[model samples]
Target: MFSFRNFNIADWFSLYRIMAVPLLVAFIWFGERQLFTWFLLISYSTDAIDGYLARKLKITSARGSQLDSIGDQITLVMGLIGLWFFENEFVLANYQLILLAFLPYVLQMIIAFRKYGKATAFHTYLAKSSAVLQGVFILWLLFFGPVYWLFYFMVIVGVLETIEEITLIFMYKEWVEDVKGIYWALKDKRRLKKKSVKNPTS
Candidate 1:
C-alpha cells in the first residue's frame, strides 16, 4: 500500500497526511501550537482534496479507498494527540465526554476488522459531515478554545456517524468501498447481487 510506484495523484495527496504526522508530533514536542494547528489544518484540507480528485477524475479504487481511510485515521489520531498534549486542561475536564464519543468508534473499528479484515471507507454523507465537524471543532479549540455548542454538535454527529458505520457493517457481508449510507446500501446492486449469488434459492 505504501508502494510509491503504485500511487496516483489522489493517493499521493492522501500520503501527504501520513507524512505530516511526524512533523505534527514535532510541533507538539516543541510546544509550537500555532504551527501545529496550521499544519494540521493543511492536513485536513488534503483529506477533502484527495476525495474530490478521486471522484472527479474517476480514479477510485479499493486500494485508494483503503489508503485514504488509513491516512484519515492516522491524521485523526495525531490531531487528538496534539489536542491532548497542547490542551491538557480541557482534555482532562472533558475526558468523559471524549470517551463517550470514542468508545463506539473503537467498537465500530473492531467490528469492521472482524468482519471484513480491514477498515471501511464508507464515506457516507453522515460520516463526511462528522469528519468536517470534527476538524472544525478541533481547529477551533486549538486556535481559540472549546466552544460548548460546537463541541456538543461535533460529538453528536460523530456518534451518529459511528452508528451508521456499524449499521453498514452489519448490512454488507463483504468489504465494500465508498458506500454512501444504509439507504444506498439497501439498493446497492453489488451487495444485492452478492447476496443472491450466495443464496440463489432466496
Candidate 2:
C-alpha cells in the first residue's frame, strides 16, 4: 500500500527523516558527540518538515503515513539509545529498578507488528504525544542531565500510549479489513496495468 514516491515534498521530507536513521545508529554506536547532536537536530527538523508539508501541500499518502510512524519509532529509539550511551548513569543509574519497564513495550511492538500487521495506529493523538514526549525527554536528558522525576512523567505518558494502542486494536478491529481492501485495490490496479500492456486497445 505504500505509494508516495511521486516527487511530493512530503515524501521527500519523510525520506529525509528515514535516511537519518542510519546516521543516528552510527552516532550512538560510535559515540560521536558532535555528529550525533547534529543528526539529532536534523532528525527533529525532518519531523517538523514532513508534518508541515503534509498539511500545507495536502500530499499525505498511505506510504507517507506509514513512513511517519516508522520515522517516529526509529528516531525516538535511536535518540534514546544515543542519550543512554552518552549519559549512562542518568538513564540507567537513576532508574535501575524500573529496568524491566520496557518489557511491555517489546511485547506491544510484537503484537502491533505481527498480530495487527501495523507498526502503530495512525490516527491516535496519544501516539503522537508519546513520540513528542520521548523526543523532549531525550533532549532534556542531554541538555539538563538526569532528572529522576522524568521517569515518572515518562511512565505516565507511556502508559497512556499503551492503553491507546490496545484500545484502538479492540475499538477498530476493522483496521485489518481496511488493509485487505487496500490490498485488493492494489491487485486490481496491477491487473489493469497488465491488461493494458497486453492489449493495446482494450
Tell me each candidate's TM-score.
Answer: 0.94, 0.75
Write candidate 2's Cα lDDT for 1-202 as tens digits. 5545465777777777778878778877777866887778778668878878887888776667777767777776777687678887766665643444455666667867765677753435555666666666677667666566765677677776665565444433333221222224345453335546766786
Colliding residue pairs in candidate 2: none
Worst 10 residues of 2 by lDDT: 174-183
Alpha-carbon RMSD of each model: 1.5, 9.3
The candidate scoring highest on lDDT is: 1
lDDT minimum window of 10 residues, candidate 1: 190-199
Model 1, 111-171: lDDT tens digits are 9999999899998999889888989999999999889999989898899999999999987
